[model samples]
Target: MSVQLRHYFRLLSSTTMKSCRSNKLLANNFIIDFNGFYRNMSTVAEVVRPTDPNLPVEIMDVEEYRRMNGIECFGNSVADPIKTFDTYRWHPNLYRRIKEIGYQTTTPIQAQSLPIVFDKRDIVGIASSGSGKTLSFVLPALMRCMTSKQDLWPRCLILTPSRELTHQIEKVIKSFRFVRSICLYGGVSYEVQEMLLNKANPHIVISTPSRLETIFQKGITKLDNVDYVVVDEADLMLKSGQQSSFAHIMNNLPKKRQTLMFSATWPPSVQKLAEQYLDNYIRVNVSQTQSLSSLTVNKNIEQIVKVVKESEKEDKLLEVMNELVPSVTGFIKTIIFVRSKRTANRLVKFLKKESFPARAFHSSKHQEERDYIIREFRKGVIPILVATDVASRGLDFINVKFVINYDFPSQMEDYIHRIGRTGRYKETGKALTFFTAKNIYHKSNLIELLKETKQTIDKNLIDLTEESEDNIIKDDNNNNNDKDSGYESSGEGNDLDNDEDESSSSEWTSDDESTNKTKKL
Candidate 1:
């Protein structure tokens, strides 16, 4: 057999034979038969056509492509724009898989980052959640395996922060059916994972950093042959305190391999991690603003904050839930986030008692239970999900119209991630945060974020800040001395009036009145 044909046969045989030791001779004989069959058919005419018949024939203009696709290319000598998957020159099987998945147009992140990744260059893609970041890396990894004519041994390693996300990525990879991939995470029997690794000999391994590190340390898996490493939601991984594991995993991998780091926000910690590992990596920012804080939350979301007494939280949440359900369109899919597992459980119990279909998701839950909850949530079987920060990072819950922060996050980064549960995939959604005086530390940051998003902020919430309090005292003193100051003597009347006007102008007029108005008058 020729060198190329021999290598192709070896790869095909390895993929077909799950057990390397027992089926070695069988795989060799099968490959030999396949090679003979291929040689017999080599005389036939080769047919080449576009992967998708509906694909445009001509290359789209660079400027027009950028505008149409919302692409922003940033790198040293970035490649030409890839308007569609067909233009990327992927293997025919991979192209067919893409078409089968019903993806005609590339998302902004996919359009810009795919070229750099396909070029085997490291990249840091800063795009919002549900912006198709998974496929941006998955496709390139699959294509890398497809073009190669060698037996695969976990050439691509994708590390995510959560098991939910790891499973999601594995699901997408499996959909292609061109490569073998396995999901590795905690809360499962290590022996099972080891068995699968030895038997499947997957081309790609999707896993959490800690679990993958454990598997590496146990000698069940090795990164010696890995050519591509992808860290999805890198910020979340670092925040979840997996930085050391991430570093250890990278340290063990071959230094010459391609690395792709993607996150909704590139905080300083994530940046430091990237600099330590990624060499001359291209940075792709899909957000309108270059600032990481502004890019953290999706601008498509409408953020609403309510400052209430601690005792009123439950009642307020019940009010919100009641309003969200029993509507003409049916109940809205919602995810309520809290800071701790205890809170999540308590909230779920209360919600259930209130006749809402609710479930609590946290690290304490078994992997199977969490997986089931996620699936049900995605299928819209459970409209209300109360979860901790564990659910914030990478799990894509489709059609989540509302995200409620029952407990304000300790950091602005967490707040951004919590709100990101909604407004995904460019869909307009609402994020309602229940703020209390106990969460004073996050008050200023929350106000700044609201202002940045151009959302109307409740003065009560903003005025609770020390700086705003000082301003309030100054205005009160001026009003007390001068009757014509316009600030009412009580001050509450003017503030209440302003709040009414703001709420009326911001929410009621724009949404409710426009949609429900009987007449223009």
Candidate 2:
């Protein structure tokens, strides 16, 4: 062994460990201890790189691999790309679990990112939501524990913005029978976290930055074993009110370890943040550059914008749900996003009074209540959920058939994320936004987003943007499309075939509209 490698192994023999700042991480805690790493990292004068025994021998050139996968990356170096989950040699149970999960093919992000991640290189992954970015880092982290020394109890740390996202990552990690994890966030119980730390002895620690800091400050947990760190939704972290916690955590980690940052949009704040802590990272961005607005809104989402007065929003929401909810049992999953906690509460009461079973979700709810509501919503126990922007981030659902913006979000980024709640995983869904006169200030941005997605702009929205809505046009043409093609295959019947809407609008077409309709959701 080289002098450097020999010296690193010496430190690994020590019994008691300090918190997290590492002088030599490769010898102490990096996930991979492959022979190629020793040769490539130690011998700078070597001419021809030896084949990686741990990876497949048939490595393609970098440019050709990028072209095949539709991946755009800028970096000093990259690893061999992956075509399927079987590309890497995984433990039999891990491979079996992936198959059981029914992932027949890798998404674009997954195919491009898994190889770089498995090579233990730093990465900044930018792709739309539902592009399978979670598993890109998650599978690699779990693989570390599956292959590591038996005493290295925790080998990875995952940080995200919200409590829901914390649990989501934990769920993915626990899919492996050998991988145990603890989830932590602010609103949850501290006693439960302490118990898990003392008892679970997990292989991964998934948390919000602030909560992880608290656990470490109390001296209950040590980061000495963490060689891999994943920052999921890195752009949202900048605004998650835990940037200081993130900085403190970064300052204390091993200097030579690997880091992965994933986000829906590649904002400058995130890029600058990545440069400070990440060393020689590769950036994997999808579709196009970050200058585009519709990065996260999938093409499968059929978007509808209806201009209604502020007072008419409640009625309009009920009407939309009535048209979309297919069965009499009312089991379709839908989410309505409001601007404030108060609005969310009021809307839930209104929805319940109007005979639509609903739940309210926001920051003010007790952590137990939030967890219960999310579970119920995800399992289809609750058919409709009225929530604030909190639900817009990383909360995954079974099948969100429709989304309604009872109030327009504060910025276009939030709008992109909110609409992304549906039409996930290449499945078709719908998003309907209630645009009132109060939201006239958002005219240009909304119109630009619609035009970029090739969606038809509402006539009322155009009038409002062209001048002002002093005399707002009452004619909204997008309503006709929804009237004809709604969940017909959902076991009840077609929404338009009902007697209620048959005599209502002169705008509604007769038998010709149903025959000529392009969509049959």
Candidate 3:
């Protein structure tokens, strides 16, 4: 064997070898032809095909647009998502600033905003919470300021629903250092805000509607000179009982100005408001279909909406918690949102009975007790928190990885607002909402919202919409495709294959299973 191998090696070495520069075979000097090989390509990472077989008609006509094939847009002449962060080449600092802050890549909302905002086109953006929408309008507002900084008043006015949102926008603007901004809202001194507005002469004003209306009424600030206006979280402001105040502020602004509105969901009220202010403007949406308006979903949140009968909730919750928090000795921050104060109290007691560190929060609780609970929750002293709608908005949780909506909110808006609590600042978090037949009113809207987020639509949810309450939808699928359906539960297997279908779901999959097929991220 050694002698034969040596003879073959000698013959191979003596033979002359030739090969093409781009991945041509040279074995035995065969002169084999290889054309257009992988090595001949220019970019290894470039995607040459869209995700779907056919591009949507609106985007198919766009000759230059190529990226974000899944994102749907409405209105004529829809702008594409930002392909590059250097949208304004003249302002070199924007590029460096975004890179420094790790916004080198744009989210879906930011992508569509690039052309509309950078080109000074009026737009209505359906941007969800924690979607980096603040930066989208802030950067453009900054650019608008560069053209007219000589003014003694604001050139841009930003109106949001809550004080928290107002300050959130202020923080983004301050980080850019391109323009000065003043946040006027309740719980802060009006005298101090007026002093800043008069003395500092901010180029951009961020405020809750009521405060700004008061400031305008007081004759301390004027928006007549403002050429750029943004209403952040328009739907929230509409729902939060500030419609008249918002109208007053909008009426006060200059008539002929670039208007931009961003909202989580597109309610009729929001659409009407946009129609009244934003003329000839493009409405940008982030979804899979060409539906008129849909909710903007933070794709980072691993949202699991479980459709279960009201009777099975207790057993399901216990099983999910056991999987998520195996060792009850230490606490992991988890919030359980209930519909009423009584439910919150009962749920917290039940969770404690099950050996989980749980606390209750609602309007019924005293301010001091609520404050103490919030402090303990923040400190990680309590792992499970049961609260009413009162804790849904404005309560900031830094690391609450899991959120359980034990009961559906009265409306879809509240549901969106409640889930927004867990997935804060584009951070990854897990949220599970228990949907019973009582929430049949939300069937259509919930289905639409789930589609917007690209989440798996459980067959049970669809069935709930079609059938009466007597016909309870259960996961009894046992076909070969059950594994492929992406449905997991802690109740009887909606698809019933693993030990018990209810216990087989990968929904509450632990951190160790992140690399697996389940949607942990």
Candidate 4:
């Protein structure tokens, strides 16, 4: 046999063994039987498509993940089980809440992880974003807290990478009503979080890595009696800025606690951290065979790309908006993802100037404004939100029709979460991304992810690439596609324009000139 064929055969054999190993891990880690789900893994992995062609989108069995090693996923892996109350079978209150939320079925991550957590077992869940892994731990953690005596300040501590996700987890925990929870993050005042830490004596504490370090340093509360600890978005926590802060928090946690580490993607660093932090833990995977539609939203999204000259990007953004706004008003809400907070603010300001009702959400906004924007967006009063990657993971906004990557994501994993914001609740949606010649080199991972999803590249968006030149930009073609391509030309060597498509007035443009919009930054 040829070398390529031999490699393929070896890969297949390894996958079969890995599948068996993963099953054993789940059995050993969670005490659940999922052999029924894995019986047809060969057929399931063979069929890879972007969208699920049926109702109540079928969840992939979480057991099919055994094949993945390193950064590559050989087959579409199922997420860990996101166990519901029925999956627990012993928890009635959780069951009632599940019914109340209208969640009749358990997603794969929820199925695999929930039962293990409910059983008070330590676990490391390696599912992708939008895999319902939050609820997997939340349900069980809250259940454990509810059953335990409530005098402790926080019996369960959940750590996430970003401040936004801390708030999201707090919201989900509060929905339980049975569990009183508090969110602690750096951007918000430490005084307020400390106040809640004292008065609420919360059952759960949702916090970002830095804030947790501060709490430990300040001697705010003892971690001596903590029973459950969760590191949500753990992979991102391992990123440069957060690694030290997380290590400090890990050192402070009680040694005899049930530790859980959850992240969208499990990289080598995260795996190493798990070995150090998690004990006899189970690992679970639930990335879709394809796209975000398998999770909450963006499943029906027909992602299209628009490549434009760096000088003309702003104009193209507005043009895309002009064509999309009317339809978005009727069908679903929209979110535009920008690379920086300044850009987010600029885009929002530009849209408002054009009489489009839009809001900018990022770490820069005041706490009150941030809350207002999220509340307004959730209530459907505001249809469009311009945001940074801060909104990417763990924040669920239902009925979002389109997710536009005004800037391509920095990480391949982040692109998945960014687009995941739309096409929720079994509805169809669309994703549009603008790739300029300037950013193509910086965004190669994003390009690879797009190709994996089987997304199509519009000719208008394909900037030509030199074989050796990773950073490439295509020459602009002044094609007469539309009547109003009023893009501006910034004279910088890069030829990048901040705002050309949307008409700008002196009154609307802010005096501060920065790339990102977030005021706090």
Instruction: Return the top candidate by TM-score.
Output: 1
Q: Over all chains combined, what TM-score does candidate 3 have?
A: 0.66
CA shift at 463, candidate 2, in angstroms?
Answer: 3.0
What lDDT tens digits, residue by residue, belong to model 3 across residues 421-456? Answer: 777766888889888765676777778777767788
Which one wins by TM-score: 2 or 4? 2
Could you tell me which 10 consecutive residues in candidate 1 have the lowest summed lDDT?
Answer: 496-505
For residues 201-253, could you state the per-residue lDDT of candidate 1 as single tens digits? 99999988888888899999888889899999887777667878888999999
lDDT of each: 0.70, 0.69, 0.64, 0.61
Task: For candidate 4, write residues 1-521 as lDDT tens digits.
Answer: 54533453454346553566544322111222323222223322211111111222132323343233111222223233422334334346755676787876666566566645655567776655455678878877776876675566578888887755777888788787887788776655567767878888877888777777877788776677777898887766665267888888888778898998777666667778888988777665554434322222233567777765655667887887888766633524889987665677667778877767887776545555566678888888888888877677667787787888877654555666788777554466788877655444434444555566567756544444432233332354431232222221232222222211111221223313444233321
**The candidate that achieves the highest lDDT relative to the unseen native structure:** 1
What tens-digit string does per-residue lDDT give for candidate 2 at 114-173?
877877789988777677889889888887888886676677889887878988888877
The lowest-lDDT stretch of 10 consecutive residues in candidate 2 is: 494-503
TM-score for candidate 2 = 0.75
What C-alpha root-mean-square deviation, in Å, does candidate 1 show against the real structure?
15.4
User: Which ten residues in a row are the worst by lDDT in model 3?
Assistant: 495-504
